[model samples]
Target: MITYSSNQPNLYLVGFMGTGKSVVGRRVAEALGMVFLDSDRVIEEKEGRAIRDIFAQDGEAYFRDLECKFAQMGHPKRGCVVSCGGGMVVPDYVRDLLKERGVVVVLHASVDVILERVSEEGHRPLLEGEDRRERIEALLQSRQGAYADAGEVVRTDGLTVNEVVRRVIGIYRLNEPNFPL
Candidate 1:
């Protein structure tokens, strides 16, 4: 029954790293006249360190717990575009929670595109080791189901940021129970 009216509802963007979540999220927030937030950035500000440092010092389990915490109550429940960290929606409860809070859109790109996009970024903790392609493939394969159930899936490959933003808004509008998809 929850649907966006004249006011902007919370919009969540979830997917693997380098899938244009943050970029498209900013544009979407601008188009919708809503606030924009990146979960990773928020967590980093709160923890006072980079995510790689968090993973290195406390390990991934700890970082994941932080992500869960953020999903639970770290950000506003409405009127914002939340660009979630790449595995934030892996947990069913968190994904379900985000869906209930608002629209959860999964922005996806092919493995090659992901590789190309993230190849230069040294902040990826999970993809730091050798054989990054293999790692991305394996991780994507493992989270396929979770991502599928996350909400609306938007493929970002070959699409401009504005294009993706438009598509996300379109999807969100049609997601109301009474509206046609």
Candidate 2:
């Protein structure tokens, strides 16, 4: 695993949709004085199109390939807090790629919480449909195991953002004690 000079491992946050990877990643980065980046945003900027457009036009296979490429590009010059797209970790290759770079933390939420969190979000292309909740539940069932296989797993049920950040930081320190938070 890649190690930072401060003896801290780069934190890559992975989770199902609506688990607040982006929001919590920002908070974690700020708390740890590290940079924050979202892989989906990077892909969107690179493709000059929204993720929905890419998926709608090209297909999920194309998007998944790009996601793998983006993840393989590795972490920042210093340590960074990376917020991966929801489906990014479903593939085993992506999981291995992340493991090589630094610590992987999967943020998990119950299906009900996930559905509620994503219900009003129009930008979530994957969750669009008549039975969005059921779809998300099915996806969660398939991915929860892979997510659990990551270096650390944090459930974001009743916890505050601060609590989540603290838990992540604690996990990072445990994984790479050489790095300072």
Candidate 3:
């Protein structure tokens, strides 16, 4: 069992799609008695449409702008768990913003695992074309360094949801000494 410190900072989860940021973030927030905010979900709610639609109707750049805006202003308080979109931290400025806000944990999974987890989901605009495996590989390769630079990296491959949550909490306890348990 781990106990946190006195200043509970926000927790930001960043990763490729299907790496369980939203799912695991919710659980971590519950464990820490904090609010959970999914950037994509918040954007969707604000736009009154799905993210896929936002991409199609506007464009990836527009959607990414929304993501940046969310990162800038969406957070309501500290001691919250924020699950960022897969591409949110790809931009250096956005990545820096998240890192400045709190402990940014990069959740990672194998390409195979990512494909398997996201296979059933057709809503991913970036993975729309054929050869999704190749796409996933390429995107992961491109963003690998950015994710690595975000903060502590947690590999979620073959790990149960509870196990991943525990790992994140452990990382938080280790890195955020000013944050109380």
Candidate 4:
């Protein structure tokens, strides 16, 4: 098994929207005594605008460029629980970078669950002006390959946040034995 020299490799949570990346990442960080950061939040804070605004003003290409930039060097190199944007790992380059930077755990949920969880959420830019279920299905299908190859998988369908956090930490510890509890 590959071992991290620092023994505090970042934990990257990647998955489709509504699959609990942000929530799980926060709790996992707390449990592990690490800092937590949602990549999208960081981008929003830096840009001083919401993601929907960015997509509307600059277009998806520009927003994706931003995601790539963040993947490259926009956050701490280690010891952080990073909840990646759902599409962050779609790019091969960013996927490779995340794998290199730390342990990656892809969170998953059923389509129905996703629809239910995100139905009332207005912040999802991609779902705007489209049938929510269809958009979620298409997005999930397109990104499934990338998510599958990203790293270990954890289904968050019915699991509580704390349970998911424990599974992620188990995966983390399997890779980084010295990481704090």
Residues 1-181, candidate 2: write the lDDT tens digits.
2233433457899998889899999988887877788998899999999999999999999999999888877346347889999888888888887887778889989888888888757677777765887888788888877888765889999999889888988887777544434
List TM-score per model, in order.
0.92, 0.89, 0.92, 0.92
lDDT of each: 0.88, 0.82, 0.88, 0.89
Tell me which residue pairs clash in candidate 3. Answer: 4-181, 5-179, 5-180, 7-178, 7-179
Off by over 4 Å in 4: 1-7, 177-181
- Whichever of 1 and 2 has more TM-score, that candidate is 1
Give a tens-digit lDDT track for model 3, residues 21-79.
99999999888877789999999999999999999999999999999999888775367
Model 3 C-alpha lDDT versus the unseen true structure: 0.88
C-alpha RMSD (angstroms) for model 1: 3.7
Q: Write the per-residue lDDT of candidate 4 for residues 112-151, one digit (tens) a residue.
A: 9999989856678899899989999999999989999999
- Native-to-model Cα distance after best TM-score fit, residue 70 in candidate 1, in Å: 0.2
lDDT of 1 at 11: 85
Off by over 4 Å in 2: 1-8, 74-78, 178-181
Query: In model 1, which range of ten residues has the least summed lDDT?
Result: 1-10
RMSD of each: 3.7, 3.6, 2.5, 3.9
**Which prediction has the highest lDDT against the true structure?**
4
